[model samples]
Target: MARIFTVDEARSLMPAVLRHADDFVAVRADLAELTHDLRHEGESPLGGLAEAKGLEARMDETLSWFDDQGIEIKGVAPLLVDFPALMEGVAVRLCWLEGETALGWYHRADLGFPGRRPLP
Candidate 1:
């Protein structure tokens, strides 16, 4: 079950979420690069493999942080997260993505990112 967050609670959590999201994004980027290099360069050196593993571990840890906070990770590359919330007594998702300055979007519980509407 998901915990319901007030708008203020969600906003208060955003700073820490953003910090971990940034780290998660960076580690994912590094993994992508390492994958490309391994594919194009015909197998990675041991050190390259080690670095990739380390990045993967970091990614897992960062994601676990979000899990610990009860935030649902919707995407990795763009760092989308959804906080469970209630808008007008109906369940909804409080949405935030990388680069957004604040929690300014939301959607019905059954809808997704495409259904996002700006929070009033």
Candidate 2:
């Protein structure tokens, strides 16, 4: 019974979504870089447990950010969406203006940006 939203409706929520997205990506990137450092150089690029804790903290921050915007990340595989009442279906996920498609595509949570597909 989750709400489904139209591309426009989703787009309208972007400003807030983007805020969370920015932090999410930054934390993700930092984590990735830290992993790379551990793998290639055998070094802890981010220092110690505080860094790990910080990543988790950032993730919590992003979730809070989404909550503030009234959006929730539901599935893991090509994320299943529960948008507003714009489109009224579970097939569509949020679409951003900068996306290659016109907010008119399907994307899984796992696939992220690469999962975009034309609406049928």
Candidate 3:
């Protein structure tokens, strides 16, 4: 079952969440760069493949941590996460993106990122 968090509960876990997120972002970026580099080079596929495999493993580990925490990763490029929350007894996602100092947005579970609204 998905974990439901209160506003305070989610904010309290921010430190750990952000730390895990940082690792996830770094590994993901490394994997992306490796992919791009491999695409441009025709001579050595094995070397890039090995590096990509390692990075992919690291990314998987990081993602697993998020899954274990019941936090939803909405995107990777910009690093967005959603904490399931209930507002006025209605289900909503507490939206957070990298570079933001605090959780400042939310959206109904049915709506995706585009429907994000500011937290009241």
Candidate 4:
């Protein structure tokens, strides 16, 4: 079932989301640092590139975290994207967990794009 959130209910999840985002940001930063070092250190650091899937798994953890909290990622359609400030191909959206209001917003996945929208 879809977890439609009221504005307030959705806002409550911000702390959790922010915390998870912080974790993700940290991992991403570490990866970036490693990538930089690889430029001087050579391709040896690129070994176990598959293990870097940890980052993707962590992201899924965030989504699953939301699912456990009762929120659902709206499918890639029927989006409530009515905004003047939206960048090309995306408009701010309201997403939430079950029995909650819209908690925050996310852009469709684009590799390494940091753009995100907190509940308005």
Candidate 5:
């Protein structure tokens, strides 16, 4: 069974989530640049294959951290995390996108991001 988070519980986790999100974004960008360098220039001053592998490992670890917390990872480029919860007995996801400052939105389990609405 998945862990269900209450609004306050989800909100309390924001600090750690934000930190992980920042780490993910930075590592992703570095990996992209290294990939581009290797593709176009045939080598990257960024340590080539070794550095790229390290970045990949770091990214995986960050993602695993979220998964271990029972938070769902919906997107990577613009990091999106969803907390499973029940609202008035209806299954829903408490949605938090990359740029949002707080976890203040949710969507029905079947609706996804397009159906996101403010948490009442």
Candidate 6:
């Protein structure tokens, strides 16, 4: 069974979540640059294929961290995450997207980001 998070429990994890999210963004950017360089120049100054592989591994590890925490990673580029939860006994997700300073939004399990509503 999935771990269901209370709003406060999810909120308490924000600090670590933000840290991993930042790291994921930085690593993703570096990997993109490396890929572009290799494609255009036949080689990159960014330590070649080995470094790219390392970056890929790092990205995987970051994602695994989220999974281990029972948080669903909905998107990579924008770093969207959802904590499984129940709102007034209805299954929902406590949503947090990149650049949001707090866990201030939610949506029904059947709905997605388009259905997001501010937390009451």
- lDDT against the true structure, per candidate, is 0.87, 0.57, 0.85, 0.47, 0.95, 0.94
Ranking by lDDT: 5, 6, 1, 3, 2, 4
Native-to-model Cα distance after best TM-score fit, residue 111 in candidate 3, in Å: 1.9
Q: How far is candidate 1 from the true structure (C-alpha RMSD, Å)?
A: 1.8
* Candidate 6 overall lDDT versus native: 0.94
What TM-score does candidate 6 get on C-alpha atoms?
A: 0.96
Pairs that collide in candidate 5 are none
lDDT of 1 by residue, 1-120 (tens): 778899999999988887887788777877897888887995664347778888889999999998888899898878899999999998899999898878999999898998999998
Q: Compose the digit string of candidate 5's lDDT tens values, residues 67-115.
A: 9999999999899999999999999999999988889999999999999
Distance from true location, Cα of 32 in model 3, Å: 1.5
Number of clashing pairs, model 5?
0
Ranking by TM-score: 5, 6, 1, 3, 2, 4
lDDT of 4 at 104: 49
Off by over 4 Å in 1: 43-46
State which candidate, 2 or 3, has the greater lDDT.
Answer: 3
lDDT of 6 at 72: 98
Colliding pairs, model 2: 3-83, 4-84, 6-87, 78-108, 78-109, 78-110, 79-108, 79-109
What tens-digit string does per-residue lDDT give for candidate 4 at 2-116?
A: 4444446556666765565456556656555555665667554534354455655765675566567655444212212211222345433343323223344544334112454
- Residue 87 in candidate 1 has what lDDT? 90
Between the candidate structures 3 and 4, which one is better when assessed by lDDT? 3
TM-score for all predictions? 0.91, 0.56, 0.87, 0.45, 0.97, 0.96
Worst 10 residues of 3 by lDDT: 41-50
Write down the RMSD of candidate 6 (Cα, Å): 0.8
Tell me the deviation in Å of residue 52 in model 6. 0.6
Using TM-score, give the best candidate's number.
5
